[model samples]
Target: MAERGRDEESGKFTEEYPKEDFIKALKELESTGTTDIAESVGCDRRTAYLKLNILEEENKVESKKIGNVLLWELAVESV
Candidate 1:
């Protein structure tokens, strides 16, 4: 389920979509842009971008920029 909470900085309600939704989206899409990710995960583009950044920081996913768009995919594990 999505969680709605107040943003400390803005004091406005914010909705948190599940990280699993993102992971699953990446799995299904293989590689995609933020707009596609948002659509697949049922959220807005900004939310998808933020979550993708978090996942990138955690090393769970990787990304590369192609012209003006960023392409995302699950991280490849090395042995």
Candidate 2:
């Protein structure tokens, strides 16, 4: 089992959260920045990016440049 540690910021025991949790969070938003995703999921920005990377690789998400920031959203499908 992974060792549990108290998070410095939340002071709560931190455990592994599945990547799907991030995906679910992203689906609820039309578009979002990296920091917003981290805040929404109660994780660090780096973890959020990691999950986003996986989602992008799986073609579940897409991103576009908006100014200097990247906005990500669920990939749209066409019939």
Candidate 3:
């Protein structure tokens, strides 16, 4: 079974998404859907969504809709 907490095999570290990682993910994807963010961060999709919501609430991340997909990226102003 997939162990709870951090999944080291997938590079999902417990230390919240660092600015560097966030930047890398954003630069690589330009704009990314939720699934892509989860894969990039090595976390489950739901976890990624939760973290994104938290970041959004903190003004650290922003989201935009492209068609029906919602893309996410770090809020440059917050950085």
TM-score of each: 0.77, 0.71, 0.64
lDDT of each residue in 5-37, candidate 3, tens digit only: 676688675565554565577678877898998
lDDT string, candidate 1, 8-53, tens digits:
9999886568788899999999889999999999898999999999
Q: Give the root-mean-square deviation of each candidate in angstroms.
A: 5.5, 7.6, 5.9
Q: Give the Å shift of residue 30 in candidate 3.
A: 2.5
Clashing pairs in 3: none
Pairs in steric clash, model 1: none
Residue 7 alpha-carbon offset, candidate 2, angstroms: 22
lDDT of 2 by residue, 1-79 (tens): 5588888999998757666677777877668998898888888999888888888888888888889998888877500
Model 1 misplacement above 4 A: 1-15
By lDDT, rank the candidates, best first: 1, 2, 3
Instruction: Give the whole-model CA lDDT for all candidates, comma-separated.
Output: 0.89, 0.80, 0.76
Scored by TM-score, the top model is: 1
Which portions of model 3 show Cα errors greater than 4 Å?
1-24
